[model samples]
Target: MAPQLDPGDLVVRAQRGEPRAVARLISLVENAGPQLRDVAAALAPHTGRAQVVGLTGSPGVGKSTSTSALVGALRKQGKRVGVLAVDPSSPFSGGALLGDRVRMQEHATDDGVFIRSMATRGHLGGLAWSTPQALRVLDAAGCDVVLIETVGVGQSEIDVVSLADTTIVLLAPGMGDGVQAAKAGILEIADVFVVNKADRDGADQTVRDLKYMISLGDRRSPDGAAWTPPILKTVAARGEGVEDVVAAIDSHRDWIDRSGERDRRRLQRAESEIQAITLEQVRARLGDVGGSAALPELAKRVVAGELDPYRAADELIAAVGSG
Candidate 1:
């Protein structure tokens, strides 16, 4: 069991490379305990340095393999890496079902790497609600790079876009990843596209398809300036072309840094994080929004034909404001 470290102690231990403390901090975030605000305050100054990359795609698209291979490549460069993998919820435990640790067993003994699995717990966009908080923990822990691999829940996995500096959309050959990417709105979010399992048939076609999509302006730039995303082929299973993928990622990072896009992205990320936190706080104060005592009473009034729903909403809003 992790020692009972308070928010301050946890931050200090994590900064000193104590993985247990880091994991515990993330656990506190996931549980949405009161300590989180204090933890966030303590972590705020130490963050804003780690290069957070997001990995997302449909299931069976070699996402985990590509992630492990990328980690190996990143480690070879002597980078301290943190991996936050979001997994599907387990029915009974409400924890990560396919535990990412099992897929990334190769790095279990590596001191330079830290991996944690989080259950999505039915949150949409394939991200756990506490992801950004967990990210801050890893960033403050001095990880030079942090990879956020989200749940592969097909097209709705766009939440990573707001959380990562560089988002990699992985797809295997013959999986219709290209077609699915467009349909699922991934085309708008990917910073780098990786055709994993490149040795398989239709790999070239997949690359071509992505190129065609990119040429059609499937990607977005807030400045209206274009960034032609590189479509790299990789055999992540065998480590082939993994370096090229890393090189592409590095290239994108460098571009973002030079083009002043990195800061902009972080600013947007902060805005979104703050907005989400505010909404969560408001809900907590209002006692779960829809399940509040005021809400049920208003429901009763509405059902009894004594008050209209619109008026009830006004009353509920007043109650929330008072609370």
Candidate 2:
């Protein structure tokens, strides 16, 4: 294995556009170990600099295209933007196609723009395992905006709310009953709703359906102010309505700052970090006690009806504690 990088040196080189350095730092963070604590400590001061925005939607909703357009618009305003696109890993191969990269080629050569594609790597939550570390790197590298594009897996995709300052859920026209999408819990977490492919037929119906759903959800701003998540129409392919999307993001940011919700979100994010760290430590200790070796036999016993899953877990815990 490559020796763990010196976090300071990695940050410096990444900011200078050294591809190898950036790749090494990302890999180290993604497959974090004890040394990651040191890296994260060193990176603390660099965080909170980037305005993190998350975009999510069902597959084929033009999330990548919309993100690309949003990045372009931000860059036009003289902002340095970083995009992290999360793609699903194949169950059998554990590899990701990272198709978002293809859609974001417009910014590939822009010095002010940086785009990275990350695999979910079987992480159940909305964020990739290394997301915090990657965000730290981007923040240190002087990005004014960081856009996270999630691998939208419907209701379970609420993880974005924890990872971003603003979360925009994307929708498209003429998708199966629009109500089906709303039922998937996508509406609950949205800071802003986007109706992409607005030029397509039934775009108005999609927007109307989403607004009606929002009304029923008892939506409010983080400060308990009566506010609805605005639904904006967009044609990301042709770059129409992108500016409005950008404006909506700005409006949310202003609201967060003035309403004190920003501080509340920061507190929530800190709590999330604590939980993630606790789980990681527990998992590592379990692995150290050869729990992986016992898993197969325990699973077989459960499948055979000789043991219940709850009992199997208790047994595993006992084995680890005794070992």
Best by the lDDT measure: 1
Best by TM-score: 1
> For each candidate, what TM-score against the reference?
0.86, 0.81
lDDT of 1: 0.79
Which window of 10 residues has the lowest lDDT sum in candidate 1? Answer: 88-97
lDDT of each: 0.79, 0.75
Error of 1 at 163 (Å): 1.0
- What residue pairs clash in candidate 2, if any at all? none
lDDT of 1 by residue, 1-323 (tens): 74566788888999999888888888887777778788888898899899999988877777777788889999999999998877443111224335544646668678889888765554553253677888899999999999888654543346554688899988888988889888877877889898888889999999989888888884445666557888888888789999998898899999888777888889987887778777766767667656656778888899999999999978777777777
